[model samples]
Target: MDSHGSSNGLREEEIDAVAMAVIAVVVNTMADKESSSCNMLMRLRQRRALLQSVAEAPDCAATCEAVVQLCVALTSGVFPRLTPRWWIKRRTGGTWEDLRLRDDATDEYFRQKLRMSTTMFNHIVAACAAYMEKKVTHYRMPLPVEQLIAFALYRWVSGETYESGTSAFGIGRATGLQAFRDVISALLQAYPDAIKWPMGRRRAQILRAFREKGFPNCFGAIDCTHIYIDKPAGAPSENYYDRKQKFFVQAQVVVDLDLRILDVHVGYPGSVHGVRVLHNSQLFRRAESGELFDATPENLPHYVVTRGYLLGDNGYPVACPWIVSPYGGIDQGADEERFDTRQKVARGCVERAFGRLKCMWRLFLRTHKTNLETLPQQFVVVCTLHNILLDTGMDFDENLL
Candidate 1:
């Protein structure tokens, strides 16, 4: 084949190239017209055919490449623009001015939106600002710390899209997203200090609270909930799909009597059973390896014949020394029945904690639209904020239900 034009009036390759270009234009035009149609299955089939043709196109490599690119653009979505409006592109130019003008509201309005009292929110803003300033280099330098805090909290609590969050925060969609991520990253950096197992007086307080509830040995209640996300395109979707037929990741949490989260383990696929999740958790690992609660048999709870324990639902294993599940079957003694009842009452904390957690940070209940890898970290940030809310004497708002 010649790289330059042929001396003849028209070359064979030129004719083929013109034909392919016409095909590309026609296909793209059809795609744009059908993009918003309700018939998605039909659209998918057409796109699949187009992709196959592109792959099988003959020796005209340049034409094949152009057709392939056009097909991808057409099949992806409606209104495919040549210029992408990603957040980085709007770094210096944002809608923050728009947000400031509309944000004149009462403290209660702020509380409802952020799911925290004014005092609690202010405290966190101060803590996160101070902590993140020392750690992150020139973090979102143009945006005010309060606006950044509001933007992050609004996204987390409302489960809004990044585009909507940007509009609300008066910034570029990408900037709003980056700000939320930076805040969460900074929070994770401080996770060790902010979210920790109770120690000394705190431990004594937790134990005392459990004892008062008629479960003398219970330190925390354990349970798991799924955080839904979009299934990836190339990966095995079945692995991420749950028994409920939804795509999600599992989050296992242990909550103390006051509804404070003591430990959290997230990032497992939803297909995994709750017990299996617990088995894979660091808490379980440490307990099995004899490092978590290194106390003598004499120091263990009297109710447990082997070791100390946390109250858990029937989804957990009864044989695990560190976890106590209620008795099963119809024929049970009165003592067994009574013990089961009390355990149920005590273990209710975990369920309530999850309920409040989801209610306050509605993001957990929504299908998180971010990258799959980033979803778990966002869940951890929500759990971290939940702990912060409980620690600051902030009560779960009943109205959110």
Candidate 2:
């Protein structure tokens, strides 16, 4: 019994020792947590005191003002303030000024530079001046109408880079581009009927000219030419790739014997055939409905033809009554061969017109770099200008061609 009681006493002693160790650990952990809490509180109080001192300091407002000014100065040095309308005052005196001073003495030079006679230039300027005029602004004086017209003409005819062209005109690149666009718009607006279908005396004159060329009741020559252009963004590039492995847009035109464009349809893809392009045009629609010419049939030597027809190459449909395409295949007889020769000569008008148009503008000779959507309008404007130049009896430098 004494042995068991001693064992129990020993166990009780061990339990007491264990309880003392656990209480010591708990007290230490609580003390450590309390110390950490006090330290955090003291730090927070110190930060509050610092903030209060800064707020209450006598020079704090001045300090902030100084800091703000310093920031402003730094920013000013880093990024200078931009002017509302910045421009350089360029000195005016170039080929344009020389031509203006010499006036009629420089008529040939004027025609060479702008592809128009001085009189025609003045006439165009007069017609477009009202539309081209800009209100005088405090920022700068508006460019003169004559200057604008001359710059536009020079740019269009020369196809010079904007940097060089603008430099020649003493204008900014943006200003030069805007001037060209404005001039084009003004021309289109002023001469809406510049490319209209022949009527009354004009129709009779066109018919007479073609009759002299051995094609009776022929209205015009129809053909298509590719206008090279950069592949348009967001459009299928393959659609514009042509047989020459170049990107282009097709323009179908009908021209009288004088090489005056009577009708034009532009903006078809380069890969599209001339027949397809023609079929989709208003010209085809009018011809199909017999609205393009009188339906009265005219007797040819071998055939009776109704509706004035357009002469086209063999690429166009010979099946259509409104169009006369050259005889194809090697088995053609003498009569057919002779007719083909005359037809080819008549068709040459459209080809020559295209050549002259491209040669004069020169812009169309290179791949166009402007927006594709504006191309049709630009082409129409050029064609109108071509007709106007022709009407004025402006001489083309065949040497340039």
Candidate 3:
């Protein structure tokens, strides 16, 4: 009857009949002869259209019963919004000073929430502040770099979702996520300056620490651990599911005696073996080419065959000469048994490193529901921060060297 229904190919006679029927009903309902029935019907339709347009206007302030009905129709799950109503809440994590002075076991509580001492946290904030700084004038929220770093650290250590962290940190979910990503990216950019294997005097210090533990010639302990991740969508997911029946990414690490991460090779899929992970690592490639561990042999104990080597478990090949694994169990002698025992003890450093790493950075302890592309960068940031914590005297007593 109206233009809205005319496009459906109604016969002219049918349209006229429908229009006349609508006009007759309207004429009977009202006593106003001031307008014709057809004109009145058209005016009624126009008013309905106006009500709908008002209801949908994003900036309109005035509303009526019609507007409320229109809202119910729009949000009845028939049409979805980019950001749901529940997501737009006030952002809330308090300031770092507020956390530091929180009256509830302040020192230990801050450490529990961030997995680092206040002093160390300050140092880290300082290290990356230049990269994460954002100006906050009267026009926008005062998003300080320190608060951004704190929010990111809180999320990483507590493994809280964006929604939960925003409520505590006093920010929106979108801001929380963006700050978390920004802080992680800044931390990764600081990696080359912060987390590096020892060389020269530092290498000597690490070697000495290993020698004290009765494993001479050991520069670091190498191993791989699976960091849980969500299965990627589509065909590429098969590459991420491992023998453990979980989706994960392999993290190859080389740690010093003090549980400090010296080198890390992250981003390999779980299906890749530890050995293959090492083979693809820069550390392994350097070792094979004799570019690493090239320090001149110095006077040492007879049991110490070389100046630099990495202690690995049976998962790696001992043929590399730089990386040593236990001998085969079959037909082994007391000497081989003793070597295996000592090697296991020496290799505990890497295992302990993994333990503390997972404990301090809770992000790695559970399955990460994040985009697969972002998981690798997150892993690298955690590793880098772990090393940075070690630099600031953070202790892990699991395997004290």
- The lowest-lDDT stretch of 10 consecutive residues in candidate 2 is 74-83
* Pairs that collide, model 2: none
Model 1, range 9-82, lDDT digits (tens) per residue?
A: 23555655656665666455554232334555675566555555544554456445746665565546422323
Off by over 4 Å in 2: 1-85, 89-93, 103-105, 301-303
TM-scores, all candidates, are: 0.70, 0.75, 0.71
Which has the greatest lDDT?
Answer: 2
Q: Return the lDDT, model 3, position 351.
A: 89
TM-score for predicted model 2 compared with the true structure: 0.75
> Per-residue alpha-carbon lDDT of model 3 for 1-401, expressed as tens digits?
56654444454465445445434543343332244577667656654564445434332232234345444643442122233336455434564446747465776766778877777777778888878877633223346787788888888887777767777777777787788788888887755666686878888888788878776667888888988877776538889887778998888888888888888888888888888888888987787777778666745445555756888887887677788788867888998888788878888988888888888778789887765667778878888888777777766545322
Return model 3's CA RMSD, one decimal. Answer: 14.9
**Top-TM-score structure, candidate number:** 2
RMSD of each: 16.4, 23.1, 14.9
lDDT of each: 0.71, 0.76, 0.71
Each candidate: how many clashes?
2, 0, 9
Q: Is candidate 1 or candidate 3 better by lDDT?
A: 3
| lDDT value, candidate 1, whole model | 0.71
Candidate 2 local lDDT, 1-401, one digit each (tens): 25764444334444345445433533332232222466556644643443343333344353344335434533442212222444655646486676686655698888788888778888988998878889844334567888877887787688777677788877777887788788889989888899988888889898889889998788999888888887778788899997788999989899998999999999988888888898899998988887888734678865675559989887877687888888878999999999889888888999999999999998888886655777788899899999998888877889878
